[model samples]
Target: MGGGHTGASERASARATERARSTRLNAAEKEKDERQKNSPNATKAIAEGMNVISTTSLKRKRSVMKQFRGKESIFKRPEALPPRFKNKDVPDYHKHPHKWVRYTLGDVSPEDMSDQSNTAAALSFLRELKERKELIDTNNIELEVPPETL
Candidate 1:
C-alpha cells in the first residue's frame, strides 16, 4: 500500500533522515562505551533496565490505572470451563528406569483433553509495581484461579 515511486526530493530526504539516525545511534554507542569503561555493571544495569519495569513505563501504567480511579478494572471473574475437557488426572510416572517410559497418558489423549481446556480465558499473571510491589516470577507461575477461590 505504501512505496510507489520517489522523486529526487524524497530520496534526498530519506538519505538525510538515515544519516541523522545513524549519527544519533553512533553517539549513543560512544556514550555507552564511555560508561562501560568506568563500570561494566553500568552496561549490565542499562541492559536490564529495558526488560525490567522502568519509570516512564511504570508512570504510563499508573496513568492508565488512574482512569479506573476507584473502580476495579481489566481483571474479571473468568467464566468456568465446561466439564467435558476437565478430565485430566495427574500423570503417574511409575518408576525411574534406564530406558524409561517417555510419557504415559490416561484414557483421554492429551489432545482430546485439551480441546476446551483453555476455552475459557487463560488467567493473566497480574502484577503490581511501585507503590505496593509484587515479585514478578515467570518460571514458577500459577495461571489458574483455583476452584476453592471460585
Candidate 2:
C-alpha cells in the first residue's frame, strides 16, 4: 500500500511538470510571434510579399506627362500653321514671316519663339498695333517700330 501511494504521487508530479513545461513553451512561441510582427525586417518582408501578389493582378501605371518627355519644344508650338502655309510648297520664309520680323525687331530669338503662347501673343499684339495705325512703318518687308518706341 505504501509503494502504491508513492507511485501515484510520482506520476502526478510528472504530469504537473509536463503541463507547466507545455504552458511555458506556448508563451515563448507567442512572444516570438509578437517580436517577428514588430521587427522592421519582418514587416518589410511581409510588405514585399503582398506587393508581389498585387503586382501580378494589377497593371503598372504610366504617367500622362510621359508623352511630354523629351518634347519640351513641341509644347511651346501647339498651334497649327495657317492653312495657306500648310502646303509643303510654301517657302519657309512665307510660312512664318512674323517669326522673322520678331527676330529682326529683337523682341524674341528663334529659341524664344518655340513657346507657342508667347509667340502667338506677340504676333497678335503686333497685328493689333498695325490695325490701330500705331506703327511707324506698315511694310511687311521692313521691321516696323511702334510709335511708343518700346
Candidate 3:
C-alpha cells in the first residue's frame, strides 16, 4: 500500500509539472500571437507616416524611467537614414540652425582653430609647439573663440 501511495504521488507530481509546462507554453504562444497582430499595424503606420514613433518611444521611455528611477535607456540609437539634406552641398546638416557661421581653424582665434577648416592648421601648430617643448602638457591648453568667427 505504501509503495502504491508513493507511485501515485510520483505520477501526480509528474502530471503537475507537465501541466505547468503546458500552461507556460500556451501563455507564451498567446503573447507571440498578440505581438504579431499588433506589430503589422504599427509597422505599416510608421511606414506611412501615419504613426509617429516619438509618442510610443516617449511612453516606453517614461515607463522605463519609472522602472529604474533614473537609469539610462538601453536601446541603441537607431541609425539615422543619412540626412536627406535636400542639398548635399551644405556640409553639415546636423548642426543647429543658429550655428551657421563656418570657420576653418586659425581663421579667428586659437580656440576656434579647431573648426573644420582649421583642424589641419591647429594640429600642425600643436605638433610644432610640442616639438619645441619636450614636456608640454595639453591640460593647460585653453581655447577662446566665438562660434561665429568662421
Q: TM per model?
A: 0.25, 0.32, 0.28
How do the residues 84-143 of candidate 3 rate in per-residue lDDT, one tens digit apiece?
666766556355656676556544664654477578778899999887675444323423
lDDT of 1 by residue, 56-125 (tens): 5456446644644665333577899867653465434443355455565666567656746544323222
Model 2 local distance difference test score: 0.63
The candidate, 2 or 3, that scores higher on TM-score is 2
Among all windows of 10 consecutive residues in model 1, the one with the lowest summed lDDT is 123-132
Model 2 TM-score relative to the real fold = 0.32
Stretches of candidate 1 exceeding 4 Å from the true structure: 1-6, 40-150
Write out the backbone clash pairs for model 2: 76-116
lDDT of 3: 0.63
Off by over 4 Å in 2: 50-150
Cα TM-score of candidate 3 = 0.28
Candidate 1: give the clashing pairs. Answer: none
Number of the top-ranking candidate, with lDDT as the measure = 3
Q: Which candidate, 1 or 3, has the higher TM-score?
A: 3
Best by TM-score: 2
List the lowest-lDDT window of 10 residues for candidate 2: 56-65
- 77-145: candidate 2 lDDT, tens digit per residue: 568865864455877778788667533647667766678968788999999988767444445425555
Give the per-residue Cα lDDT of candidate 1 at 22: 72
The local lDDT score (0 to 100) that residue 81 gets in candidate 1 is: 82
